[model samples]
Target: MSFEDEWAECQKTANQRSTRMQLNQTPDGNYRPGRAPGGDLVVHDNELGAIGNEAYGLYQHLRTQGDEARPATFAAATAMTSSSLSLGSALYQVHDNWSTQLGSLKEACAHISNHLDYSQKRHKEDEARIATGMHTVSKLYDYFK
Candidate 1:
């Protein structure tokens, strides 16, 4: 399959995983091993944060490349409207998805803040890490072949 197909498949896998995680239920009505019935707050937080970060990085990459008319990558780009508005709309969808996911990330960050005793320095460091992660994501996509 092509890159876009692979990407969509990856998304579907993630969605399936997330849904399974969210809908977990034990017949005994008690927490399960490794995963709390309510879900391990830390693990859930981490998963949400990670998914948010990925979506953000994806949005950035799509915004950077989507309007560049990359027929070399996505064949669908060929029939796409040449209008900036159309491209912008697609890019905006990515942005909007990222924005929605960002809430979950912020909650995860808040958990970190609580554990870290509200250290501004640590929070700033985490922000830097996020920026660096976002940059690395672009490189990763290209490097993955």
Candidate 2:
């Protein structure tokens, strides 16, 4: 069979399997695994903190070192512009394009760092709020009992 036919067959099989629980289920109706019945969203504080830290580090590195070649590039472009060679204009254009791309990359790195830091802080606040609500609910239940 052709690649397309094989791919379609695979997709059909996947669709059929997806409709049923393939694993993590026992013969009984109850879930056998230690996990919750429905899908759960879990996040680790350390992992998120590490990602934010790494993004910030990358931002700092890019800000400090990514522009190291700017001076040389500018100087070369200036020299080429001053010269009467036919490639002078083209050289300056290349320099301009490089500078633009470098600036864009620097901005992207900063954005990633800032976004990750914000997400980490917001996640902490959300977790604290959830924990406080749960505790209050548990106390209410104890009083009722």
Candidate 3:
């Protein structure tokens, strides 16, 4: 059989099979083995900070390097179109699409970085507030004692 035929047959067979996705619990609703009783998930601050830093770095790199070809591509497209070559329009379209997709990717990276940074800062603030409240409560109890 040809590659396409074989690929299609494989896809059909795969689709016919059952696919199960269990998150935190088994299909019968019990917690999965080795999972915490409450299925609690933990994330450390340093991990989040690292992820945020990486995203920021990627954003900065894309901002600087992603458009390195734009000027040349635009000039080529303009030259081609001016020369009445139909390929120029296609090139222009490709350039436009690249710019749009690049913009979206950059925005996503920025959003991830900013959100993680915000989350880290907000969590620290919350911890400080809780600690201060507990200290105040302890002081009040001591005064009463």
Candidate 4:
């Protein structure tokens, strides 16, 4: 209702979000115990991982080269050429390997389904957290009156 009230509420919610990010966690995908996929706050997807890492490398290289409007210098050209080729080759190999195994990788695909379940459960938990936060704030409003 008042500025002080709003500021306090904002600080309270921000603190709640920080705490949730640190304390909350989703269940791991099924993989026979020590073999489950490793990633935080993401559904496990091998193809996506390969693509993301390659893109990250490329982005870093581009930033280092600078964003010149015209053609880059010889040194920059050489840098980009080598890095791009290496990253592309690695990604291509991974893509080929997965593609070749597509038909025979039925068991691996089943694990993806497990990741789907994990993601859904995490989403529901997050919704509950939001509801709880709202209730807490509502009660705080009554207390401050």
Candidate 5:
């Protein structure tokens, strides 16, 4: 096909894709009620706290158990290296990679716990701010009475 034909076909495909209704959007391009203005983002405080606690527990477990093999693995690597065995290099590399991966996992667990905790605190602060604003507005109206 000519370049112009290909361009026209591409344009038609793009238009069709853009006009398709997405999961949270309606045919008229507005977000569905439960996902937008009228939606409730109700998160149970206890549930969020539980999740954060679970993440912290997992982090603690991994820190100890995951490193339980560290001494053995390093000892084996050192023995192999001192024996001038070709396997020494491979063992060391494995040890290094494993350490890196374990560190990443620990970091991820900690991040999850911290993020959840911060979210809970932020949500409570936002609620408090809104409540205070509403109370102030109510008092202003009463003063005018």
Candidate 6:
């Protein structure tokens, strides 16, 4: 009704709302053990493999096609320098920068691909180890029974 009343009401409402971080919690503010409502970190083998393959594919494509304009660009830059154009040095710098950036992008892609492949392999090994341990535990439990 009044400005002071509205301000007090807004403050009360804001104070009633939660401001704490709710990491891996359910909607009712309970902490779920295995998976929360937001879900757990799940990376399937096929998903990892697909991402790695895509990264590798991108790297391969960049390696083969990224430098297609290098020769022409350099030649043009050189010709411009020979013709006494002031922008020749800038053009050459641009070409160099482009090459550097392309190399960096290719390296990044390769790294992503390799890292994902390694992670996938490691995950499978871990799962296998866990399964073996579980099976051994079950056998021991049955023997005791």
**TM-scores for every candidate against the unseen true structure:** 0.23, 0.61, 0.63, 0.28, 0.66, 0.66
* Best of the two (3, 5) by TM-score: 5
For model 3, the superposed segments whose C-alpha errors exceed 4 Å read 1-41, 134-145
Worst 10 residues of 4 by lDDT: 20-29
Tens-digit per-residue lDDT, 38-121, candidate 6: 654445778888999999999999999999998889999999999999888999998999999999999999999999999988
Sum up the clashes in candidate 3: 0
Per-residue C-alpha lDDT of model 3 across residues 4-95, encoded as one tens digit per residue: 99999998997776443333455565744346344344347889999999999999999999999998999999999999999999999999
* Cα lDDT for residue 66, candidate 6: 96
Scanning candidate 2 in windows of ten residues, the lowest lDDT window is: 18-27
Reference-based lDDT, each prediction: 0.52, 0.69, 0.82, 0.51, 0.77, 0.82
Residue range 22-49, candidate 1, lDDT tens digits: 2233644454434645643223445545
lDDT of 5 by residue, 23-118 (tens): 333456564434543335555678888988998999999998988887888899899999998898898888898899999999998999999999
Question: Tens-digit lDDT track for model 4 on 70-130?
Answer: 2323344455557875555555554555444543344344455455556566766875796
lDDT score for residue 49 of model 3:
91
On a 0 to 100 scale, what is the lDDT of residue 72 in model 6?
Answer: 88
RMSD (Cα, Å) for all candidates, in order, is 27.1, 14.3, 21.0, 19.9, 14.6, 13.9
**lDDT value, candidate 6, whole model:** 0.82
Model 6 RMSD to the real structure?
13.9
lDDT of 6 at 56: 99
* Span of ten consecutive residues with least summed lDDT in model 6: 18-27
Q: Write the per-residue lDDT of candidate 2 for residues 1-145, one digit (tens) a residue.
A: 9999999999888766533332223435454433435535455667767777787788788778877877777777678778866676777777788778878887887787788778878866876786577568757756764
User: Whole-model lDDT for model 5 versus the true structure?
Assistant: 0.77
